[model samples]
Target: MPPATPDAALTSATASPQQAAPDAQGGVVLAPVAETPPKRPRAPARERTIGTKVAGQPAFVLHSYPYKETSLIIDLFTRDFGRVALIAKGAKRPHSQLRGVLQTFQPLSSSWVGKSELRTLTDAEWVGGMLPLEKTALLCGFYLNELLVKLLARDDAHPALFDHYVSTLNQLAHNEPATIVLRKFERALLKETGVAADLGRCTSTRAPVQADVTYVVDPERGPRPERASDPWPRVAGKTLLDMEREDYQDAATQSQSKQLMRFLVAHHLNGAPLNTRQILVDLSQL
Candidate 1:
């Protein structure tokens, strides 16, 4: 079934990565600064497998909207189940426990049930500890949620991506730079979705990428060196190499990587615009 509302269509709420920097041309290069914090402990009450009834499955409320006069429909990203839609029954009441818990950005251990397309959120608890994002970091955090809602399919599991997400969120909560964090997450997202071309080797020649060449990442063909003012978005080979190492210290690399990613993402999205992306663009800080 389709979502009760468009993914995050009704979030009239305020919310909340990386060693990042402001893009000289208006973008962000968020890469990991330090190791990701430890993973949240698995909810002990969770069933051994992902089934109709989930108990304390580690999850995040990606986005939510009022479902009715007294309930809410939420899109959740679960550790095992990927993007799952759950109805937070009666969560709209001012006194409801779920009201405070079903919030974006914060981590939670959630319980839910139902074999249908949409499930029911039975329980949620805050997995507190990390600092909340402020100012720019908070917007970047919402941008992450937007990407997940748009790119990932429901019920598909990518444990690696999920772990990266947890790490990304933790980094966002801290003083780490933001550009590197977003870039790393964007790369991970593309990789998980199977659309990102490899950065390690040239696609056409299968030659290992060198640190000194200039290359353009072919969305279909992989990274190829720049040629005579190459048309496709361009980045230095060192930048690609640095990105492969998950590093974004070089200014040229940060600027170029941001452009390369935007082009590839736009191509893959087939002209479907990302609203958050546009907001970032308008604010000149993606």
Candidate 2:
């Protein structure tokens, strides 16, 4: 077309770059820009999972603590589920049904829901064992509880360890010697958790522990000869062999086994004293 006015050209150039249509009033209209939708937040992962029946499983309450005003959080070691935490709602009430059934070391048929680290305990029915642990045995039972609480991780199942625990409790309840039963359980716990040292063989010589020889228990590496400078206890080869066979009945084996396990457990515990040990020591003198 012929030369346009400066104002008209400027208006055409500055207008939006989209093709415009005529309005009712014969004015050019620009299309409206679309607004973007806002983003939504993601939901957290569900803790519960679907599963089949866990009915009639053998289990025991390892320990428990007050959760709030009327509830308690129980740590259980079940035959199938291993170590799991359960919230026993209203378990703290004076007449709560669960109050009588959830005592430690008593066998129970426990039902819980969810695959969460903390499961909700649905039901608990007591299954009595031999008899209640009393005197020294009771303290030993608490010592076992403390070990499990410190070493075992939540929701991690160890069926063999569970069985061993049940057996240990039964032994303790039957008035078995505290030192013997505790040593057996401690060794089993260590083995089940994959921290047990080789008791039958020498680390350097790769030979069976001989009854005539004296050896040092290396907590990290197993049994070896006592070095000229090492301060750990030197155990007899017979003691190592006895430990390997779980034979604490022999007098010599019992004595050396205690010293060996003490060295090994203390090494793993890194000088952190077990309160139960001190309690036992105090009670023995009285």
Candidate 3:
């Protein structure tokens, strides 16, 4: 303490800087220091996009809806890409090049772009089909669309199902019995979606279904015994076998096959009704 250094004095002076000043009430007062504002981080740049062609892709229009004033939002079922959404700019115009090309139940080759789930449709060219669906078949075609919409996930390809759908449409267009064609398609749809069980064997026992035995068709499961308590339709093993072969020619097979498919489809639909089916029923009633 005899000769305090200048460094020690300066340190002692600044150490109690707050206490150095006092208000009238004897409360310590602190001086404000200038603060540098925090710098904000910059945003990341967006990825650059380039369009490419999807050549010779087989596709069909599942459904289309109006968009804006001059465009349409088309849901396409492609051979290799499953269900896809495409924006058809200017498709609503009176003379749009794609106006006549984008139609349901008709085969098509479509081109589009964009990496996002919803793509832009650049072109659509119709490939002539077996024929256009009419009468009861028209409503049945919509039923197929509804099934695809409800069951199939977007952009998941099923080439075999796509082929089956085309063949089903052709059968309907050619006036193959409505019920038979529908049953075949429904079976194919369920099988392709991985929901259908083995038609030949019992779920409980590994035994093959005998042609004479009466069995109960379980929707979630496969065929089993027709128990005394359960109220579901009891189908013959022969009927099930006929369905497996897609042979609906026999009168008995056709009648029973309809009931079987309807039961199976209703089970998977979870009580949500198909309105197109009701239309077909009503027309048949007339």
Considering every candidate listed, which one attains the maximal TM-score? 1
Which ranges of candidate 3 are over 4 A from the true structure? 1-53
Residue-level lDDT of model 2, residues 69-89, one tens digit each, is: 999999998876678888999
Task: Give the distance in Å from residue 279's predicted Cα in candidate 1 to where it truly belongs.
Answer: 2.4
Q: Which structure among the candidates has the greatest lDDT? A: 1
* Per-residue accuracy of model 1 over 1-63 as CA lDDT, tens digit each: 776565465452321225677778989876645666899768554344455587878898889
Candidates sorted on TM-score, descending: 1, 3, 2
Candidate 3, poorest ten consecutive residues by summed lDDT = 44-53
Give the Cα RMSD of candidate 2. 9.2
The TM-scores of all predictions, comma-separated, are 0.79, 0.77, 0.78
List runs of model 2 lying over 4 Å from the truth. Answer: 1-54, 284-286
lDDT of 2: 0.81
